[model samples]
Target: MVDLLRKSEAFISQLSLVAIVDDQIVGYILFSKIYIVDDQGNRTPSIALAPVAVLPQFQKQGIGTQLIERGLSDARVLNFKSAVVLGHPTYYPKFGFVKAEKWSIKAPFDVPSEAFMAIELVENTLQGIAGTVEYPKEFQEVS
Candidate 1:
């Protein structure tokens, strides 16, 4: 997964938050940049929350939530205007994700409407944003 992420141009940035248990890596989460086409077909910047993984023994311990919250906070601090995620509908709203379709934004592939989500880091950043979420080619090869 790391190799595939490293090879993608759309991977503008990436971060890994780790949880150590007994001095061993027990959890990790990654965030990567993604692009979306606007009405005129020009690319707009955004980030994607993907491939968050925790060792089976660590599941349900709030490690994933902490990683996501910290990652989003970092994105905001770095001036990222917005973020999108394809994930469990029930899980993302706690981080402020709403249905992207509400803003006319669609994922490149078919997914449950509730599973495709987005959030604005700054107020009104997504005001005029609309269109398709295009993930990096590396995602396609491995997805």
Candidate 2:
């Protein structure tokens, strides 16, 4: 999946971040372009946070947290309106992600509501946005 996303046309290198310690990568996170499409077929651009990981030796440290924080900040600077993540219910909220359902957003696949979350980069960016998140074909290729 990582390779596919990186190679896909939709991949934006600027949105991929890594944590390096002593010249070795200790953590990584990728925020890729996605969309929120309403029932009427209106599409709202967004991002998807995926493949966030820290090396086993680096787990429980703050490396993962740093990666997430920095990545989201960069996304906001890039003018991304929002972001979604299918991640741990407890872990992601520290970054302000709420259940996407709060805005009537849904995931394309079955996932616990708590595990699928979204956040607005700009205040109220998702106020009127609602729909299933449309991930890139690279995701489907891996599934």
Candidate 3:
């Protein structure tokens, strides 16, 4: 999350969400632009949700949910077509996430199919836009 804050471009700033209490940050979520490149070399605009975090002491209290809601809501407003995530299968499905593979979309890395998920922001956006996901360059530095 910090790497995205420090290195990702301005568009990420528009969709990143935070939760605060008494001026202390309790949680954060980021939705950054990614691309889906097809065989013909066309690219579809997409977003990636990742690095959602809440202090260990704050987990299970809904702060993370609030962060995700805020982030994805803003992403829709920003006109992103779809969003992808590599997260717990059960946890993310509650937020409308589903296996990206279902749409024929694949993650850049080989992860468990259930854990690699995506959600459409605009109806039908992912209907035929399937390909490998491409994350921003700075994501390589995130770990």
lDDT of 2 by residue, 79-137 (tens): 99899999999999999999999999999999999999999999999997889899999
Candidate 2 or 1, higher lDDT: 2
Alpha carbon lDDT at 89, candidate 2: 96
Residue runs of model 2 more than 4 Å from their true location after superposition: none
lDDT of 3 at 131: 89
**Candidate 2 at 120: error in angstroms?**
0.3
TM-score of each: 0.92, 0.97, 0.92
Which of candidates 2 and 3 is the stronger one according to lDDT? 2
Give the alpha carbon lDDT tens digit for every residue of 10-60 in model 3: 247777678888899988887777898887878888888877989998999
Model 1 Cα shift for residue 90 (angstroms): 0.5
Q: Candidate 1 or 2, higher TM-score?
A: 2
The best candidate in terms of TM-score: 2
The local distance difference test score of model 1 is: 0.84
Residue 78 in candidate 3, Cα distance off native in Å: 1.2
Q: Between candidates 2 and 3, which one is better according to TM-score?
A: 2
